[model samples]
Target: MSDLSGSERRKLEKLLGMGSGYVLNFSDRTFGDFFDEYRVEIDNEQYKTGGTSKANRMRTFWTVANNHVLGRVIEGLIEYANEEQCFGDSNPSLVTNCQNIAKRLLSDQPVAELDALTAISDDYDFEIVANHVREAIDKNQPEAALDRLHTFVNKLVRITCERYNIEITVDKPLNSVFGEYVKKLREDGHLESAMTDRILRTSISVLEAFNDVRNNKSLAHDNPILNYEESLLIFNHVAASIRFIKKLEASIKTKSATALDKTKDTKNDDFIPF
Candidate 1:
């Protein structure tokens, strides 16, 4: 069984209960052997546990309020169950169904909460990166996820340059793209705040480090496996960067359009109509 911290276990327990919405009843006749095998001490004879003792304890933990929370819980549970071996050899059918549920949860079914990077950008690259990276995470393939995140950031830089008409090659590294973006923002009088300046500078450093991590550890070439926390760190940072860049591009376009509109109004009377 893969190591599960206390919090993950709690989250999984909550997920299992949401499946039926009604309190899932486990008979002492069928699941008893399985529960006994796992040494789960039942709290009451009147009520037996579902998958584990804690399963019953946390059964009513979540209200069936929304599918979004339910989906997240299921995804987390499936990942946890696969790792924890809670539904091992005794229940192949259950495991199969759980796996199916996880896949369904991940498939193009509109999730409760859309991933901002993919949903906001309207870019095919963003969609690909979000889907594949999530699949990697679900499968515990951190290396693959981190590699995709690296590529995601790279594509973001390319898209930003294309959208803004910035005179930089799409092939440039993130740090270089960041520098050019800042320069353009300044020249266009769009770099307005010191806070924005600090964020960009910090983001460039983060991108550089992320790039190095992908090169050294991810599928770029095999190395020591990356842990979950490290992978999550890189993923979140890259996501934030993507969201920030997209917003920046949007802001620039809005400002440019407004200026163009004003300029056209100013020149309207100067034109001679045939």
Candidate 2:
């Protein structure tokens, strides 16, 4: 269940046009489609009964959804309202109020880091694994996501290696692939700070141990899972490393593009008429 206070919930209900029997500017079909985009089944019998209004359905959703899903749904509604011009001169503060509520609801979620992983790649396999991790995290069950997170990291590292022309085999474990990527970054002069380099080296061992956790202590097998706090800690650690790599790769692309532009300019200069 979400942690929204009663006043906050009422504010959201009013801003979303749910104070009446409606929700935002969505029709019945469009409402279902909107929820479906986030994998939320709002039409389930559990959320619907005899003459249950759309407002009530949304209220039910808020009552049962975890913070992560609740935050996403709220943000979706805000975006939809903006697109539909639901907030006209009649209610000038509607958008700001909605945004403030969303910020409070999502304040402690690790949504940005999770989003960063998918931003790094659009591979079908990567998205599938990323979604599983997201579902687990949304349901507040990080332990169940451990195996999927490992697979996601492996895919990310392999993609990074391929992008940089670093040799990697499928059989190589996550730590090995990641270690090689780190070594390449250092060799290519991308590792500018001693502290950053040390962190990457530490992540190598962390991912090495993660293999064992995925195999033995995770949902990958019939063994007891790690406790929630430690699982969350591991998730945060791995996510931070992924965010760092994402920035590093982005910087490399920018530099390569700049160099290519310079080369083109040089060629253009040489082609000028005498």
Candidate 2 — which pairs collide? Answer: none
Q: After superposition, how far is residue 132 of candidate 2 from its true place, in Å?
A: 1.3
Task: State the lDDT at 229 in candidate 1.
Answer: 60
Q: For model 2, where is the 10-residue window of minimal lDDT?
A: 110-119
Residue 149 miss distance in model 2 (angstroms): 0.4
Q: Single out the weakest 10-residue window by summed lDDT for candidate 1.
A: 60-69
Please give the lDDT score for candidate 1: 0.57
Compute each candidate's TM-score over C-alphas: 0.57, 0.64
Q: What's model 1's TM-score?
A: 0.57
Error of 1 at 87 (Å): 17
Residue 191 of model 1: what lDDT? 70
Highest lDDT, which number?
2
